[model samples]
Target: MDIEEVRKVASLARLSLSEEELATYGEQLTRILGYVKVLDEVDIEGVDPMPHAVDLQNVFREDAETESLPREDALSNACKTDGQYFQVPQILDQKD
Candidate 1:
């Protein structure tokens, strides 16, 4: 990529770069793109796409009814709360 293209991208990413940094980044990005171009030329006719390198499986147990924690005990861990409910900071910008 060119220095101007790098400067545009850096501006979009909210980065503050000097002229030297822009030139350095331009060269680095060009090298990275060249490496990716080489990867694109590789043959993978029968290769399966993988999300993870290792095999993974979810192990589940038999589900049974269980007792839940009491309301008073559950509310004990809150930073701030009313008598019956958790009181969190208001997030909206309304007058009410």
Candidate 2:
């Protein structure tokens, strides 16, 4: 592609570029497109597209409920706490 086309692409991608950056990207994109054009000429008679290079299988275990730590131990480091639970500022408080 030409430098003008590269500038347009940079605009569409929401990228800011100086004149030097535009020139650099223009050359890079041109070379990349040239390489892709060369690849387009290759023959692939028996090739198979891959989801992944290796075979894969699903492997998951059943979920199970588990108990959490005792409330006293869990809340031991709290800045402040009521008898049974940690105290935090209310989310809906206007001061927040």
Candidate 3:
């Protein structure tokens, strides 16, 4: 990538980069693109496309229900509360 290409990308991303930063990012993007070009030359005639790099099976544990906390105990540490629920400041303005 050239400085102009980097500048264009920075503008599109709404970035305010200095001249030195533009030059630095241009060189970095060029190197990264070079790596991608090298990957294009790799031979993968029979390789299958996979979602993950490694094989994964059912990795989750079985869900089981347990006893729930009492309502009073759950609301004990609240900063402010109504009789049955937590009270928080209203964020939206009421319009007529």
Number of the top candidate by lDDT?
1
For 1-96, candidate 2 gives per-residue lDDT tens digits of: 788998899999999999999999999988888878877777877988678988779878778778988898888988999968878878785674
lDDT of 1 at 30: 95
Report the lDDT of model 2 for residue 70: 86
**TM-scores of all predicted structures:** 0.44, 0.43, 0.43
Q: In model 3, how large is the Cα lDDT of residue 19? A: 100
Against the true structure, what is every candidate's RMSD?
A: 7.8, 10.4, 8.5
Scored by CA lDDT, what does every candidate get? 0.90, 0.87, 0.89
Candidate 1 residue lDDT tens string, 41-81: 77888998888888778878779888999899999999888
lDDT of 2: 0.87
Q: Relative to the unseen true structure, what is the C-alpha lDDT of residue 4 in candidate 2, on a scale of 0 to 100?
A: 90
Clashing residue pairs, backbone N/CA/C < 3 A, model 2: none
Error of 3 at 89 (Å): 27
- The global Cα lDDT (0 to 1) of model 1 is 0.90
What is the C-alpha lDDT profile of model 3 across 1-96, one tens digit per residue?
878999999999999999999999999999989888877787888988888988998789768887899888899999988858999878679553
